[model samples]
Each structure stands twice: as C-alpha cells, then as structure tokens.
Target chain A: MRVSYYPGCSLEGTAKSYDISVRHVCRSLDIQLEEVPTWACCGSSPALKMNRLLSTALSAHNLALAERQNLSDVVAPCPFCFRRLKSAQEEMARDPALRQKVEQTIESQVNGNLTIHNLLGFLTERVGMKAIGEKIRKPLTGLKLIPYYGCYVVKPPSVTCFDDPANPTSLDEILRAAGGEVLDWDFKSECCGAGLSLSKPEKVCELTGRLVRDAAWRGADAIVVVCQLCQANLDLRQREIGLTDKKEYQLPVIYFTELLGLAFGCASEQLGLDRHFVDPLAVLKRKGLA
Target chain B: MFRLTGALSEQEFLHHVVQRSGQNLLECLQCGKCTGGCPIASEKVSGPRRLIAEILSGMRNEALKNPTWWYCVSCGTCMTRCPVDINMYQVATALCELAQEGGIAPSERDIHLFEELFLKSVEKYGRVKELRTVAAYNVITKNPLKDMDKAVTLMRKGAFSPLEILSGWAKDRKVSRIFALARRTSEGGHE
Candidate 1:
C-alpha cells in the first residue's frame, strides 16, 4: 500500500519519535509512504484564528501541492494537519466563492482533491484490520492501553466525518486487531490542554496529569494516542504531576504506531522506544515483551 | 443623540464575524449550553456562549478585550455539544481575531505576542522553526532570555532536537507568495 504522507512540522521537530515508529511500523506492514512534496505549514489554530482567508489559502496551497502528486490519497499523521487540510477541503467543497479565491491565490486550479485520511483511519480502513492483524508477530497479549482520541483526531463530525464524535471506536478497534487489550475510559476524547502548553504550562500539567492519573486508576498500562500534541503534552508533563500533588504519576505516554511497532515485533531501538520522556519499556518489560 | 465612537456598526460587525466564522449569530438560541459544557469556564473567562450572545449587542469592546478568547484551546467540545450547531470554536476564534484587529486583546498579551512571532516565522521560512520561533518570540515580547533555563532542561531530557534547526526552509517558495497575497488581502489591500 502506498499513499502521500504529510508529516507536518511537529513530526519533523519535537515528535520525531512518532515519525520514526510510524516509518518502522509501515515498513513492516509493507506500506510505502511518499511524503507530500515540500509541504508548507498547515496554518493551525493560531494562524487559522487570525485570518480565515490566509489559513484556507495556506491549506489550499498544500492541497494544490498534493494534487500534483500521483497518489489519490494524502495521509497526515498529525491530527492538526489532518484537520486543517480537511477544513480546506470542506471549505473548498462548500463555497464556490472561496474556491475561486483560493485558486487565484495559488495560481493553479485545484484539479481534484485528495481524500484526507488520519493515521488511525488510514491504518484501520485502508490497510484493513484483517491485514494489520496478519502482520502482528509479537501480539500485545497482556498489555492494556487507553486508545486516546484527543480533541482534533475525531471530533466535530461534520469536519472529521469519521466515527461517532461522542464515542469513537476506530482506535480501540485497531488496538484490539493488533492484539492489545483496549481499556474503557471516559477521558478517551478529552482535550490534553496542549493548546495552552506554552502560554499556560500549569494548566497543561493539570489537565495532562489528570488524564495520566485517571488512566492509571482505571488499569491502563499506558496512554496510547495518535496526535503529536497529545503525546508531547502527556509524555513531557509526567514529572509535572508531582508539582500539583505529592504523588508522581509516571504513566508512559505511548504513540499508537509505537504500540503497533511492538506488536509487529520490531526491536525497541528501531521503533525509537528509548526516546520517550517518561520511559515506556517498563510496561513492555512487565508484559514480558521486552 | 447617539455617537458612533470606537464601535462597529451592528451590520458591519455582524458581517465581519459572519464572513470569517460563517456562524449566524442570529441563530444562536441563547440557551448557554456552550457555557455549561466548557471545561475552562471560570470567573476570568465566561465562555463562548456569552461572547457570541454579546457580539450582536454592539458593545463588542468588552467581549473583544476579555480573557476568554485567549484561554480558549479550540478543543471543539462546545461545538460538539451545541444543540444549534453554532460552531462555538469558530465564534470564539472570530472574537479573538476582532480583538487582535482592534488592538483590544487586553489579557494574555504574551500569547498574542507569541502568535505574532509564530506567524512571522512562517512568513519567513514557510514553516515554524521551533527554536527560531521561540527565540524570536522571547526577543519580540521583550523577554529575550525568559525561557533559557527551561530550554536547557528540556534539551537535557532530549525534548529539544537541534537536527531540524540546522535543516531549514522548504524547497518551494510558492508558500511565500501565498503569504504575501494573504497579508495584502487581509489588510484590505493596504500594501
């Protein structure tokens, strides 16, 4: 399987491990990921909030770039990127006036649009749950995880158009297919306070710490997520849990692709397991997968 | 005698918000469901429901300058829960834009400053360079070395990777042109 990939700015920067594991897992699954050619920023909330025209045009430029690629589908690993691109897609589809303006801005006609796919959506639907199950050499038999669908990954159904916005099941379905036990948790779709990480670090710690403690209390081995913002927020803020309260919640935040890599029997180093701020190998060791 | 002093005409204000957010403020039922579902609702920030309800009141100065707009994370919880499908996220964001345009974002000035630095980074390099953006943000916000200690700490924990810093700029410069047009267009072709 092959698809155009837009890794976004985070994957190239702070969330490098996510990209590493995504590549490792995809290689093992025999999936070819051709990157979106020199794609610019997707103009997420900060830019989007400032100017809708700029944000749409910025995203439309990426779509126009994506149109040049031979692939019919473009998969964005970052939830932020996925949402922006999808917003551009929806806006272009919904408004002929905006489409005309965007086309003029980009200096090219948007010949055809690529179907925007999130990481989990692409993995489960396009790759097929059956095929994913087939590639699991070292199935995660004993481990239990909270398949965290952070705010942007699958909410506002009109924009995302995938899964029930209130109670999504794609991640849980994918985890089960890969042989990991899915834990039922209410914070599955809550915000991780990543938006305020810079301006409001304390709030970020408060929210992220709460999710970690809740996941631990509910018997989740680790918090599994697809968004880089969610992973960075929860993973980096594990130590900050002690700042709020006496107890330090040392919950290891695991990216879903890293879990898939482990299930596919890739070695720890190859999947960038050692790079996590709060180590996740302890859980793997406890499960005897180490 | 009513004087138009530092206020948008109701139709013009409504039109600006409607053009940008695409949410019809008239359709809002004023049920305050957005406030009820908001996780960040507090004394400081009332919530989007209040902001939207007041946008049509023609006294947008207070709403525009409120702390609520900056604190919003755009998580879409209110949008998901709204019975009328009001798109509270868009409304809150539009308020932020209006506040920014009017220079009335009284609270959370640092966030707005950082936002400016962030956009400037994108305008220059076509993407946000983490170190560059943060460094420029500090300098521009008059805190040139504000987070140096934190930066050192995050780096020790392998959170700050310098690999991306060295590898700079996208190959395509068409993004620069797009940004140029965006600026000229957004500022009413002032350039």
Candidate 2:
C-alpha cells in the first residue's frame, strides 16, 4: 500500500531517527511513503495560539499539497504536526468558506490541497494491524511498553478524529500486534510540557521526572511515543532531571515506529537506535526482540 | 438561591461556557471527577467541573473574575480523567484570555514578568536561552537568589551545561518560526 507522507520539520532534523524508522517499517510492511514535496512547518505548537487563521492556513497548505498529489491520506509521524494538519483538514472540510479562505491565504506558501493522518491512524486504519502482525518476524513477547499519547494526538476530537479523547486504544492495538504488552497508565495523555521545556526546564524537569518515574516504577522496559517533542522530553530531559534530582533513571524512550521496525526484524542502524541519547538496543537485545 | 441578571441571554451564556470549556455544561454528571483529578483544584475551592457549572448558569461576572483559573497548570489531568472528556484547562485558558481582553490586570506580578521574559528570550535568541531567561525573570521578579543554589548544584553535577543554555542555529530554526508566527498572530489580535 502506498500513501503520501508528510515528514514535518522534526522528522527532517532532531527526530530524523523517527523518520528513518518509519520509512524502514513502511518498507518492511510493504508500504510506500511518497513524501509530500515542499511541505512547510506545521507552525509548531505556538502557531495555534498565535494566529488560528495563519496556523490553520499553514496546515491547510500541506493538505492542499496532498490533494494536488491525489493522495487522500498523508501519514505524519509527529503528533503536533498530525494534530495541526488533521485539525486544519477537519476544519476546512466542515466549512467550505473557511477552506477557500485558507487556500487563498496559503496559495504561494505550499503546493496542493491535502488530507492528513497521524501515524497511528494510518497504521491502524489504512495498513491494518493484522497486516503488521503478519510482518512481525521477532515477536516482542515479554517486552513491556508504556504507550505515551501526550496531549496533541487525542485532544479536541473535532480535529484529530482518530480515537477516544480520554481513552485511546489505537496505539495499544498496534503494540499488541508486535506481541508487546502495554501498561495502563494515567500519564498517557498528560503533557510533557514540550516547548515549555526550554522556557521552563524546571517545570519540564518536574513533569518529565514524574512521567519517567511513573513509567519506570510501573515496570515498563521502555516508553513509546509518536511526538518528537514527547520523545525528546521523556528520553533526553529525563537524564537531566535524574542528574539534577540525584535520582537514577536511565529509562529508554523509543519511537513507536522503531519498536515496530525491531518487531519486523529490521536492523538497529535502520531504526537509528544508536542516535538516541538513551540506548534502547541493550533492552531490546536482553528481550531477544532486537 | 441566587439570580444572575446579565447582558447575555441564558442560552448565550451556556453556549459561551461550553464553547470555552469544550464540554457540555448541562451534561455534566456532577461526579466531581474534574476536581478529583485536577492537581491545582485539590488545592483550591473552585475546581474546574464546578467552575464550568458556575460559568454556565450566568455567573459570568464571577467566573470571569475568579483567580482560580490562573492556577491551572494545563496538565491535562482533569480532561483525561473526565468521563465526558471536558477540557477544563482550555476553559481556564479561555477565562484567563477573557480577563486579559477585558483589561483585568493580573493580580500577581509574576504573570507579566514571566510573559515578558519568555517573549524576550524567544524574540532575541529565536529560542529560549534558559540561563538568560531565568536570570531576567529573577532580576525582574527581585528573586535573583531563588533557584541559584539548585543551579549551582546541578552545574557541579554536570547536569547543566552552558552550551545547552546558548541557543544554536540548529535549535533556533524551529523555535524562531514559532516565535515569528506568534508575533504576527499577536500583532493581528487573532490570538
């Protein structure tokens, strides 16, 4: 199955590992990711707060690009980008006049009209977990993963249109496909204080400390997330927090796609396992899932 | 039994409350789950769920004026735990925005100070420069010594790095775009 892909900004940069793993996993699943050419930033998180119209227009431009490509479903790995693009699509689809307005606004910014899909939705709805399960050569039998949803992926259901706002089951379904056990946790949808991590590292540290500590305490071998910001926060910031607090927690945070790649028997380099601040290969090797 | 007489009609008031909170005020089961799950609500008299009802029932003036809204940390606990999935943090943010729009000055000095410091950091550096931003905040708030010991201790432990605090081009691009967008939006009054 082939679908248009929007790698967003993070995927090309800091979270390039996620993009690599996603491409590898897609190949393993026999899925083609035709990347949306010349897509701009999803305006990030602050765009929504700054100018609703401009932010919506920024996302709409990407969607419009996808539409031009005749790719109805565009897979986005970053939850923030997913939320922004999907929310813009939903808003535009609901209001024709709004769509026209945004199109006019972003006519020169990006190419084509688009429809957006977060990785979870694309995998579950389009690819089907059944197909994914069939491709799992190395089943993660005893590997316990804490699925961290973060805030953007499931909130304000009007835009996301993926899963239950309070209780999402799509990630859990995907994890189960790889023969992995998911823990029931409250912080699943909790904020990792993403952008605030820079502005307010103390608060970020405090919040991240709680999340990491909770995942570790719950006996999770690793935490899986879709957002680059969430991954960076839980994976990298946790180390800083542990150091500052004099607490010892070297919890490995892995992208959901990386885990899927491992389950599909993809190489460690293909999953970019070494690039992570926290090495997850040791844990995967120990579980014999690598 | 108190009555509220306001410019907004009852339905209009209810709609406004629901729009801000993104939850059906009338559909609330009054289970207190919002209050129960809220980290800040536990420490305050007016929890989010109760605040929603109060705002919906034409207690607009009081709800708009309430200080409890600012206490919300935007942690998403209340929204996640709510059986009906009410976004209480959004409600709190809306109320705060409304207050700001109405020219209701912030009671606490930290609000403006933090905002100024944060915006300045974003504008000048294109990303948040932690040490500089914190230093500016401390200077403006007159609490320069606060967190100093913790900072020193962390530095000694090699947990804090000057390089990390200095915003680089690699880190600045994404953050710069966000800031530029924010500035444009704020200037447009569409925020």
Candidate 3:
C-alpha cells in the first residue's frame, strides 16, 4: 500500500486541488503515499519538445530518487509527469545506450525497475475496485459522470503500456464501483488541449468547448478527470469557452479523486472541491451527496 | 569535381528526421490514418500525414517551418491509429528541435516562444513556478492581463501564491545540472 509519489509541478500550483484530493483519497483508502524528496519537474511537454535526452533525463532523475525510496512502485497524479516518467523507464529499460546517457545526464544510477502508475492505474490495478468500493460511505448513487481519460495517461501504447489506447475502461470501472453512473462517451480519451492553453487559449477553449458541450448533451452531472490539464482546461476555461461559443455551459469538471473522496465521506473542503472554477458542489448538492 | 551547396539531399533529410524521431518514417504508407485521428489537422495544417509526406519528400524547410507541429498538443492520438505506429508527436518534436537548431523561423512563433520560456523556467528553477512563468510570458508577449480573470480566481483559491518565486523549492542545483548535461550529451557528445 506504500508507494513513492511524484506530484509534478502543476500539482503544486495550477492543479493544487488534484494534489490535495489525491492525498485525501489515498489516506481514506489506507494507501500510504511517500512523496519523493526534493523531486524536480518531470520535464513535461516542454522538455519533450526541446530535447529527447532532456525529457528522458529529467524523468530518470525523479525515478532515481524514487528508487532511493526503496519502493517498487511510484504514482504520479499528473498524466504529463506520469507519461514522461513511465516513458523514461521504458526507454531506459529497452535501450542500454540511452540508459547510460540518461544516468550520465542525471548523475544518478537509474535502475528503471520501479513500476510507474498514473493515478487511475494506482487506484484500479494496485488498490483494486473491491478495496475502493468497500470504503465508499457516501456512495455516488445519483451522481452521473463521464470519465475523461484525456491523452497522456493512456496513449502511444508502446510507452504507457497501460489500458486500452483507443477506449480505456479503468476509470469507468472505478467510477462505477464508487457508485456513480458512468456514462458511455466517445470523447473519454480525447485531448483537452493541455499546455496549449498557455500558448493558444483559443484552441484550448475550442477543444474544451466540445468536451463540455458533449458532456452536457449526455446529461452527465459532471466531467470526471484524473489529469491536471484536463481538469484545468475543462474547469478553469469554462467562462472563456462559454464566451467564445456564446452558450451558457456551467458543467462542473470534477477530479476523479475528489469524487472518490466524497464517496468515502471525506468533507468536501478536505477534497479541495471548492477550488474548481465551475462549482461542482452545486451539482453534488443537487444530487444530495454534499 | 563540383563544390557542393549546404542543402541536405532527400535521403539525408529523411534520415535525419528518422534518426531524430526514432520512429520508422519509412514504413508510413501515406494512408492518412494519422490525419484522420489528428485533432488539429485542418485545411491549412495538413497534420501528421502531410508532415510525414513532407519529410518523405525531403522538404526539410516545409516540414520544420510548418505550424502544424507547433500546434501539436502531443496528444498521441495519431500514433494510436497509425498503421505503422509512426509517432507524430515525436516526429513533430524532432521537427521543432531541428527547426530551432537550423535557424528556421517557426510558423507559430507564440507557441515556440512559450515553449522556450517554459524550458527557461525549468532550466533556472529546477521546477516551474507556474504563476511566474505565466506572468513572464504575458509580459513578454505584451499581454500582461491575458489571464487576469483566471489569475485572480486561482490566487483566491490559493492555487499559487505571488510569493512562490521566493520559495525554497525554486532552487535545485542538481536538476539544473541535469539540464546542462543533457544539453551537452544531446548535442553530439557521442562524437
């Protein structure tokens, strides 16, 4: 139940709600999360685009730190970090030349043996739905959600090697076990424009508008997500998206962990549910879960 | 016996892209499978399929200068559906890196600038100070109030503090070293 945790840069800043909710949910689930000490950025998308070696080494440095923790598993709540860390591990394991270069760049020995899991993977594969279901004190019976997998958590099948690339089922299964009605949606694994929001807000708003509109059309109470960027774009940019589209869309973008925490009877504030741009509590209250 | 100009031949251009991306560009069938799944592919931006075609045809300037790659969110949706499993994300990354190194002006300058600023933060602080990066980007891009509304809301929610720039986590020499060493090794240290 104990694993090293890498919260990534976004989790500490723009996605602080995800970090807090993740901690609360893990505590409620009795899953011990030992944060990797002095963890730096996992190099995210910028590193990926700037230099392959930089991106790989950045994640390798964190993995080396994780390896020092003496744990066999590490969980990254941010999908961008998760992908970078896992991709580094995979590339290092497959190519010893790349491994040596990464080790040299990081100035640390990377064993590349530790299992990297995105939050959904940790919850489903490690914690299991059975264990998670047992702790749901306030089941999300009336709450309906479309589980948004986004991109990084499950893509480029060679790197992630987790879940179905086209249609992932882990999030849906977990939500169902938590007693929420999981709506079947085609946009589950769609991209929410991610870091593009920083450079091109219009594109992100356009992409996010599609997701929000579809979720609303499907009659979902909220769009459930595990990735920080997905939550941010889907939640933080609702106003911009609404303004551009000239439609009143007040859909709540809830993190999967927050939903789990609520189901586990954790106080809404403890789960950082109040931090969302679009108020999720209104929808949760309407369902009588708050 | 003729002196040669510096232009890369078609094969050489393709080879560089292949080596840079580490993807099998030669295996691409131009099926447009990648383009079909691409989110940002459009009339102006031909997406992955066209980029790959440009690379195949040795149109180095076109491939590198294309704004399509810059706009790529690295979604990996194209790779998921690619019959040959060509990772357009990596290919776009290689093009961007090549474009920067080769001194070609990026078609999408803001994205390029934003990425540069983003990496500069990581290079300096080991971790990105999100607010600081955003503020710097906004100021540099001449839109100081770009996300003023969201910033105020996020500040109120304690997502990040104005004082985060002064935090202890901003300094990490080891992470800084990683950036320097990686840059060295990536720049043909093997040679």
lDDT agreement with native, every candidate:
0.78, 0.69, 0.85
Question: Could you give the fnat of all candidates in order?
Answer: 0.52, 0.04, 0.76
TM-score of each: 0.92, 0.71, 0.95
lDDT per residue as tens, model 3, B1-191: 11224556755677778887889787888888888888777778778888887787788888888778888888888888887788887887788778767888879878878888888888887888787788888999999998788777867876567687556454688988888888777777332
> 2 or 3: which has the higher DockQ?
3
lDDT of 1 by residue, A54-166 (tens): 88888888888888887889989998889889988888888887788777777777754688899889988888888898988988998988989988977777788877777
Error of 3 at A112 (Å): 1.3
Tens digit of lDDT per residue, candidate 2, span B1-191? 22445546555555655664355656666788878765444343477767776775777667876645554544456666677776665566556555556677754335445655654555444333446766777777677886565566445434345565544434344334544554454345431
Which candidate ranks first by TM-score, i.e. highest? Answer: 3
Pick the winner on TM-score between candidates 2 and 3: 3
Candidate 2, A3-61: lDDT as tens digits: 88988756754576788999998988888899876666665544443245656776776
Model 3 DockQ, alpha carbons vs. true complex: 0.68
What DockQ does each candidate score versus the true complex, computed on alpha carbons? 0.53, 0.12, 0.68
CA shift at A120, candidate 3, in angstroms?
0.5
Docking class of 1: medium
Candidate achieving the largest DockQ:
3
Error of 2 at A244 (Å): 8.2
Off by over 4 Å in 3: B1-8, B165-169, B189-191
